[model samples]
Target: MPTTAAESQFDELGSLYEDVVDWPFRRDIELPAVLHSLGDLTRSDVLDFGCGAGLYTRLLAGQGARRVVGYDESEGMLREARHREAKEQRGIEYVSQLTPALAHRFDVVLSVYVLPYVASRDGLRQMCASMARMLRPGGRLLALPLHPDYDPHSDYYTAYGFRLVSESPHVEGSPVRLELRVRGVEADVTAYYWSRGALEEALHGAGFGPVFWAAPWPPGLARIEDAPTVQRAYLRRPHAAMLDCRLARAAE
Candidate 1:
């Protein structure tokens, strides 16, 4: 059967975001550390922001979470996630990002590769604030933001390969690259490479503390040692700094 136009559009967008590709590389390296950093998440409510295919949500269910909810902006992707539920027979709920009326608070909130799509610095700040707002008191929100160092406006960027560059002491080098796959036409998508420093400030301003830290690919996992054709840094959140807990509150 021929693919529908909607699906085709989605496929293009996915490719732009590297969503069409399998990320066993990232999942293998980051998932364990991300799960471990939660301290004790057993029986806790989990929210998988940008839950592509709900893979993390399903993983959470396997980890003994009392309940899990996956949120994504893509309906096509949600359809695939629903398919997983039927195939694996796992109990998971998928929700639209537009409606928040039935919103449920969570013990842990995590957004993997969701923040950079937000566009502006203000948008990123708003996202952090929203995460803080959704958590219960003392609840943790884990966010993996694309480092700002690899921005196109920066000098460290490469037209074809990845480069590691720094913006400040608080900010470290974010590895970034752009991959041009041969799919008929050349399309370009930019991912903000992340650094440790920028993440802390964003989180602090949003109302969260940094308690743990680890690169998505700390070790064991294959490192794109040469650097990503573009890749961002990983920001670990815990209690390293004070949070503006009221920031998100005031916004509401």
Candidate 2:
């Protein structure tokens, strides 16, 4: 049977997880520095939104997050996350919904490279709004998304004329890599690419302010390795609204 749109998306994501799992940690990099600067995770409630394979959730728990929740839309990914949790004996919870049931606000929320798949403007807005509401006042949200400027579909030897320059703007023309398995079944994946302005506008429209942006080169790994072209955005929620009331107001 063919994969559903949701399944196809995750099938691609699962293929890329292997590359990311050994990254930063395997190379001893400073990828977490910018996020940690936003807030102290020690004994703080944290949620790893779209926490594929629960790698970052484990990281946060190991770093002493009071509670770490991992939520994703992929069952295969969640199964792997649960297996890892059991093997590591970690206390992170994995849910298969975009927004799981949580009564109270969290101290910090972080999402790594999961926003672009959110192709719908309304859905994306709802996600941002949900994240903001999931936080306590002054809580922070740090997310990384694909650089909007990078084109992922255009082939290298296209109709347009090509010339040599001092340097190339990309490692791989397409930052995302799609891998298929033995039976021609697609499996793992990784994605990176985003523009600064588009990200800012998205967050601002979502009601988040005081954004901090950074493009830190891979701390210990070669820049060309893994097509290291990621952008990080740090946004803090100065205030939060009641979920029902916010929706009601928006509907007014």
lDDT per residue for candidate 2 within 71-146, as digits (tens), equals 7878777877888888888889887653435623577777665654453445455666666666666666777554
What TM-score goes with each of the models? 0.62, 0.63
lDDT by residue (tens digit), candidate 1, 1-252? 111112223333433333323443344445665666554667688788777667677778888887788877677667778777888877888885625552336777777666544534565567666666666667666665553322343333332222323333223332233343333434444434334555567677866665355444434445555434333322222111211122233223
lDDT of 1 at 91: 81
Q: Candidate 1: lDDT of 76?
A: 64
Q: What is the C-alpha RMSD of each candidate to the true structure, in Å?
A: 8.4, 9.9
Model 1 TM-score relative to the real fold:
0.62
lDDT of candidate model 2 versus the reference:
0.52
For residue 28, model 1's alpha carbon misses the true position, in angstroms, by 3.7
Instruction: Please identify model 2 stretches exceeding 4 Å from their true place.
Output: 1-7, 11-16, 23-39, 98-100, 149-195, 217-252
- Please give the lDDT score at residue 41 for candidate 1: 63
